[model samples]
Target: MTLNPLSTPLCVVQATISQHGERAQLVGLSMPSAPFGTLPWQLIGLANYIVGCQTSDTAPSPETFTAHMQARATSAIPSPATLYPYTPWHDGRVRLLLDVTLGPAKVLKWPQASLVIMEQESGSGSCDWVRLSRERTAERILTRTVWEIEAEAQLLAGRLREAPDPSTSSLLEVAQKAARWARESRKAARAALTISQAARARHALRMR
Candidate 1:
């Protein structure tokens, strides 16, 4: 089932979760160069959070995950997973509102899990529900996930330990902690991505 029911440049995807079998699945996603033209990395974080949970055996409680996500953006430790600089409240509103509705639901059938990625295209009065094939979705998620991890790693490496001017020592200390958190998040995200998927992600990295 589509979420928005309107046309859009950014593709929409749907994944169904079952009580058994694979947990969270990357249903489908499309990161178009239009609306996301300025912040494609945000897409990677979105993909990881969603797919990573789907693939995991033990999913985080919606509230816990939501808070875990919020702290990343609001705290001194800003995560690449956050939309801090780009959107107000760092997209927390979307997470708080839509995500809770995504979990297992009997209405979707006995299997009890389903989700849809919906986005509003700029200038388009109506929201869109894009369609992407399974292969396309997996490819996008894997590629984006790898790119985000590497980009963040590079950012942390460059700033994490930079010696601050004497006057800025206090700021540096805060940065250090934030960097550590970002590093940990990256490590966890990498680990959460299954071994085969990680391999594919790396290959995708190499190809680019």
Candidate 2:
């Protein structure tokens, strides 16, 4: 059965300065199966992520979606995590569930292509539990700042490829180069953040 599009899970990963030096929020979308459930989450998220490109007040801030699969990749123990989007239908807050046994897999297969919304057999009482089965939801939140950089790079490259004038072509090529450089810089920043987090973890362990 098809699930409700508006009911899809949305997890807020971070609230920080965006690539444009403006306040923004990064979110993750967990997808369980391919051919997403007709929800425009990624499209919406992409638009939010590129809001800096637009010069409109109504445009949303830089938000991103990190797609994840609910299935366990390795044959080892299964540990999983889940998030519930903020919906008005429920109480003021929603419950996020995490499974210690089964872990989630990052579904990098063509961006939300393998996401499936899980459903429970019983329709009464534990509706949230039902939604957990095979639900296409984001398990872990990654710094989505790279998405904007990568998108800008792609846009610049496309413009360069289709430039009608030599001057415009040169400018687009230069922009594309800069965008690529920025994308690389974002990658390096992410790597550095990972290292920083590891170091903090080690320090915390030693302190204990």
- Per-candidate local distance difference test: 0.36, 0.32
The local lDDT score (0 to 100) that residue 200 gets in candidate 1 is 81
Q: Which ten residues in a row have the lowest lDDT in candidate 2?
A: 101-110
Tell me the spans in candidate 1 whose CA falls farther than 4 Å from its real position: 1-39, 47-57, 75-120, 124-140, 147-208
**What's the distance in Å from true for residue 51, model 2?**
22
List where candidate 2 sits over 4 angstroms from the true fold. Answer: 1-153, 156-163
lDDT of 1 by residue, 19-45 (tens): 334454322222222322223234443
lDDT of 2 by residue, 1-208 (tens): 2334444332222112233344444333233222221122222233222232221222222221222212321212111123334331232122222211111112221111112222222323554353542222221111232343356446656766776567656545544554454455445434645666688899999999
Q: List the residue pairs that clash in candidate 1.
A: 12-130, 17-113, 24-54
